[model samples]
Target: MTAAKPIRCLAFDTSMTCPGVAIIEVRKGKPTIKALSHVKPNTSRSHAHRAEVIEGWAMLFLDKHVGTAGFDYVVREDFAGKTSRSNYPVLSAWNACERATSRFGLTFAKYKKPGKDTEYLGISATRVKSLVAGSGNAVKDEVEAGVRRITGYAGTFANDDESDAAAIGLAWLIDAGVIEKPKGAG
Candidate 1:
């Protein structure tokens, strides 16, 4: 539990099980968590009626966060690019992110090492695991343990996707230099 940063940011997660949005504003040494939302998604394996709902939800989220001042960047979970799998939920998440960025005119990006030219950086699952937990090959239980240790939430928060999304946001916050890096590691 270190000090937060004086930076404003919005993070989102879109999928069949969990859809979430969070807005964190930091300024003048004052950090404010303005908004955080998570709802059970109305989705299906085939992505039934998902695009329309995503558009609507993304519009609402944008209205809430990017009303007058647009967000600096939009961060979403990046699919591992496994062409063999037919994960409609994963595709839906990617598509929803794409739609959100286009709808709000927000730039999409990832934090890749030594690559600053493109907005989309190569963030992989191993990196996320390591960033959220201590090891790249950490299991879900380990991730939840790290998250609980970091956030100090209750027992019900275990295995929740929203909590994982928040951890991902925290990772980006630290990576972007928006927040102070974790102790003993960068």
Candidate 2:
């Protein structure tokens, strides 16, 4: 039988100021990082402008790298509207990502193909932390360390945003069976 095509997962740790992105590719059940970067839109700009910048950036990135083939999964850290005040700005950034993913033809739900169990949308930060660090309440530093251990990545991440994006992507990979879950994970 012929070999299967490699699967790509693009994950994001979305924020209005600086959003992180990571692209992970799995081939034959082994996973590797394809790219990691963050967009730092001007904080002085209005929320609409920042959101627009983020949307444009993501569209360009997808076009240049992922192309028409697109990613098998696109995930972002869920926007938990925990505060009483309206989280309009944060929601805008998240919506920008949603638009970008939709533009590439990825539906905001789990794929419905038979025998395929892939998720495609927001994943809770607590869930991502639990999957990556074995604790739902894992701190940012702990999550970063756990990502390093799980992915066997030794290089330093530019910031926590990048590491969080990696964590989010790896967690999805494990959940989707694209990569094996690490030993001793709860």
Number of colliding residue pairs in each model: 0, 0
Local distance difference test, each candidate: 0.60, 0.80
Scanning candidate 1 in windows of ten residues, the lowest lDDT window is 150-159
Clashing pairs in 1: none
lDDT of 1: 0.60
- lDDT digits (tens) for residues 103-147 of candidate 2: 878654443223557543467787788888888899999998888
**Poorest lDDT segment (10 consecutive residues) of candidate 2:** 107-116
TM-score (all chains, Cα) for each model: 0.71, 0.84
Q: Which candidate ranks first by lDDT, i.e. highest?
A: 2
- Give the per-residue lDDT digits (tens) of candidate 1, residues 1-186: 966434656666556566766565656533334566665655453465665576567677677767776666567655555563556666766676677668777866666754455544335556556776777787777766655554444545423565556556656665666655444333
TM-score result, candidate 2: 0.84
CA shift of 124, model 2, Å: 1.2
Model 2, CA-based lDDT: 0.80
Instruction: Quote the lDDT for 35 in model 2.
Output: 81
